[model samples]
Target: MQTITSARMAAIDTNCEYLGIKRLQLMENAGAAVASAVKERISSGKVVIIAGRGNNGGDAFVAARHLGGYDVTVILIGKKEDLKTPEALHNWNVLEKTSIPLVEFTNSTFFDPSILKNAKVIIDGIFGTGVRGRIHEPESTIIDLINGSGAFVLSVDVPSGFDPDGGEFDKAVHAGLTLTFHKMKTGFLSQNAQQYTGEIRVVDIGIPIEAEFYVGPGDIQPFLKRPAISHKGDAGRILVIGGGPYSGAPALSALSALRAGADIVTVAAPKNVSDIIASYSPNLIVKKLTGEILVEDDIPIISRLIEKHDVVVMGMGLGNADETLLAIEKIVPLCTKAVIDADALSPQLVPFLDKNMILTPHAGEMKRLSGNDVPDEQKERIEFIKSFAQKNEVTVLLKGAIDLISDWLEVRANRTGNAGMTVGGTGDVLAGLTGALFARCKSPLEAAACGAFINGAAGDMAFKEFGYGLLATDIIDYIPAVMKA
Candidate 1:
């Protein structure tokens, strides 16, 4: 049996749309599935859908329209005008035309408790799988009413108030049957969720298998969590150790980190190019070192700085000198999470490489790291890279026409980039993007895969704007647009 976490499910849906599947069609299919599940449980009775003003409510509205044999009443948990998504609001408008009773959840006292008490089947669509934390307000009071009633509950997806990823919650719905879509969610199999989830049934809404296998704009789902009350440095505080012999490499990296949504980016560079790198962007926090290139002496201060940031991105234009390699060996291992690229991909740095580190290497750097020649053929290259990653127990992102990201056991191939991405500084942008994403993503492999996809997709977008004239900076310019899409 195949399964998907909430993040993966969302990514798959995004890919579905990217592949030309309409969002409204998926919603209709989801609603039809919910209605069928409800009908299977109850032959005929009064049905009450407790809906929130979101996609979840849209699903309920679709279900209400399909349940023609039952006496349906929609208890919208919020104002009808409050629906934020177009699909949800569209469904809400459609339900308004029908004769089914439409009630709004204005306050605790406004809704009739008898509606829930008299319901033979109550659809718990107050929240979808994305919801987290404590159940509050009218919904909190309504949750008590629903639980208090003898109604046969049919929850849309996981029960409302349940964290699909599995966690502690203030309150959660106890459903007799949970009609999950496409695949099972994050917490579906956990022992803590079994009682709350009830008899779980996976519904096929026709999301293609290719959606699951391919990397798309949806892969960035994990990086998009923005809480209303989030504090500073909540997104990511990235420390970049590079610069010197060449300045723009680290500058490109820091800017890439910033563009990829890292809250703060600090570049620690040599004296020769620290000012130059700093001048590239006022957004970058520059830490000036004593020498022209990385030396053994810089390790102590770099180690101290590493403690302050969430992820460290090392070796973008720090020339491949002997002292620089020594610096990389000393600095990379002390850091918690890192992206080792550019001049930092020396053989000596391999000992410091771990699962927490993402190594972005082209053919030459890959050959140097593994002492194995990379075959020109795609299949052989994948096998070689996969084997090397497994043997080293490190994440390897092989940069090429088709990027191959592997974390020993699992692998993902990203074909989003075009031939125009052969420009000089693009790899640095990719490394920075990966580090920025690495700070937020739970898995290093996921971050690397998303990094490759976004960088390549942005490159493709740039290619569309400017043919063979595509520059590395152009990819950087397109990062936000690609991510937003």
Candidate 2:
């Protein structure tokens, strides 16, 4: 039941000695659990266990020992001489005594399809949590072969060739079932991981409960729970103030806020655009403001609207104007918590920094906020952004190849999006999502981190079907998928 990140798993491994379990015993338990799962699934099928040179392969070897009565074969991706860990070598020695067929992958010998033609189950052990970079040529070829074979593939620990924590791999094994050890890795929950791992099963290998206590529970619980007796107003109210020429943008933001668990959503737009926004979503309560663009005259009315809502989302599709700048200055100071994005992130409004506020700015908007003319380099930008957020006592989410979220305490990097999110209005959706969470969250920093992670994950999910053609609306559609119970 423990939901842990990859770093937490590594910490468990490093602190195993203190938990009173040897590494060898943990590996044994892992293999036995996997073997039990295999035996339950296919009683007498021809089993082909793909073995690497790591501990993951060692688990496969142990499973082969238990499956000796059945028709089983082990395929080692590398030569026997290249075996790394002591546990892996010990398992290999024990497996060699059995009559089960063994094959070493090499340039001279071609992988015979006949070996796996009748195999009812295929075990993937090519790589595991320790895998880094892209899958090399031969491994990529192996993954392709496994995928094309149409066999029921079961991956041990994790699907081979996938990164344990972050980053995308060139190729990975598409497993019908994945048997992960101890705790679930962060990659197991990602949209990209779903492409390779069909169904995930976590095996508890007798790791101490203290192992989980070390990392503490993840911060996602607050977003997952629902109160049974709560009403619409109790959940939280969100006010979205943006929409003029780009009418669809504000609607997208408002809907996303509702989708991200906001109970009541109100869109404040010009009279001409309010009708269009209201027509798009019946859940939205649109308030028709007097001006086409948010002006100074609209500030008093906007402040009154902000009082009813728990949080406010500003700056999506807000056209740049002197009146807009003045309106933002007055409105920002009045709201308890606000999410500022798009044209509302101008330098003129930088002085009103509230720790309760979150700013969702893309690279260009970030440059405007920081008044920096430098080119985009991730490390340099993150450092500068952290300094900016700390100086202002606000949370800033800098959107780019990898999203960097910062406040005074810490900087968390989110690597969960595809290039498909470059479409317009996605930022508006993100701003709305942040605003929704901001209403319920204890701090602005948590809201920002959770919002970025959830939004990027939704975008990643949308990218799977739509690929590069993913629209902003597609991201909003998949928000429920990412935020599933």
Candidate 3:
């Protein structure tokens, strides 16, 4: 019984669209399922559905049409034109043609508590799993009224005012039965959440199981939203801390970060390579360190710089010098979020592995980090990486054919790149892309999963144009196209 979290459910829904299953079809199936579930418990009554403006309300609209022999009425808490999603609004428009009594409550204080007093089976569709923070306005009042109405309550998806992720809120609708679509919520089994969730019912809404185990364009769909009033640095600010022995490595990483939708990228490197890195691209901001390589004296300033950025990319071109690894080990804990790559994959950094960090390592680095050789067989490789990542409580993106990504419990495998991707500097592009996504994604595991998919997809795109002559820069150029939803 794999419980789906709110974030994972969103990914699965997007994958359904990518697989050509229309959103309207899924909503129709969900509404039909709710109608069947309601009929099994209460055959006839003055059924009142308190629907919000989201997709949950759309489900209620569909259910109202199929609830045979029942008097169904819809109470929409917001304006029908102000619906949140396109599918929800479409259903609302269709409901207008039916004879179902439609009651609109636009403001918080207008709806009367007596409206639901006669409800024998009140459907609670006021809020779904998408809500966060405290409950406000007419919805909060509605939650209380539903709890006290003494009606046989049925919640669609999640109960109104209840956190689907299991966090306790101020007020929540206490329902007799809850019909959740697809799979059971991960939080529904929490301590007191079942009290409000009642008898949990998992309904199949026709989403393919392949969508749950694979990575596709749907994984990056959340990054496509950009509010018009958003300012600079709102997208992401990344700091690249590398480039001592190799001049080109840090520049490639910094440039790739900018191409991956990061608003700001700063490359802080040794003095010998700082000017060369800055001269390669005008999009990067280069900061010069005191020494030619990472050293003990640079820890204080690097720590301060780590605090300024949203995410940090460390160890691209910083050769495996003793002093360089030492600097990496010290500065990693200071970062808010990070992508640890290249020469910094020292075994000493194992203690620093956690949910906030992502370690992108090739076969050799994986061997060093785990104190074992890279296994030849696919199953052995997955078990080794999965076990080690779980033990350390960190997200590991082990780079190889059929890239394995794990955060101890859940693992995602990626198969998108070609043999032409076996070139130098391609991994650096992956590291920078991981950094840019880590700043915006919900978790480190999600960012690393997206990184592997996008980086490999871009490599395949470049390989088509250049055959075996694909340069690392060619992959970077195709990233934006692959990232577009």
Best candidate per TM-score, number? 1
Comparing 1 and 3 on TM-score, the stronger one:
1
Stretch of 10 with least lDDT, candidate 2: 212-221
- Measured with C-alpha atoms, the lDDT of residue 184 in candidate 3 is 89
lDDT rank order = 3, 1, 2
Q: What is the C-alpha lDDT of each candidate?
A: 0.87, 0.82, 0.87
Query: TM per model?
Result: 0.84, 0.58, 0.81
A best-first ranking of the candidates according to their TM-score comes to 1, 3, 2
Q: Tell me how far the alpha carbon of residue 316 in candidate 1 is from the true structure, in angstroms, after superposition.
A: 3.0
- Candidate 1 segments whose C-alpha is farther than 4 A from its true place: 1-8, 99-101, 108-110, 116-119, 221-237, 243-247, 261-301, 304-310, 319-327, 373-386, 440-442, 480-485
Please list all clashing residue pairs in model 3, or write none if there are none: none
Please list all clashing residue pairs in model 2, or write none if there are none.
none
Candidate 3, residues 144-228, lDDT tens digits: the string is 8889898989999998888888876778899889999889898898898878989989988999876776687778777667678
Candidate 3 global lDDT: 0.87
lDDT of 1 by residue, 1-485 (tens): 55567767778888888878877889999999999988888899899999988788889899999999798999888787888689998998998899988987787447778877678999998888777777778888888888778888889987988888777787888898999998888687677787788889988888887676667767776676677897879889999999889999999999999999899999999998999998988999999887999898888778878999999998899998888888788887798899999899988878777778899999999989888899999879878988988877889999988888889777788889988888799999999999999988769999999999999989999999998898988999999997783
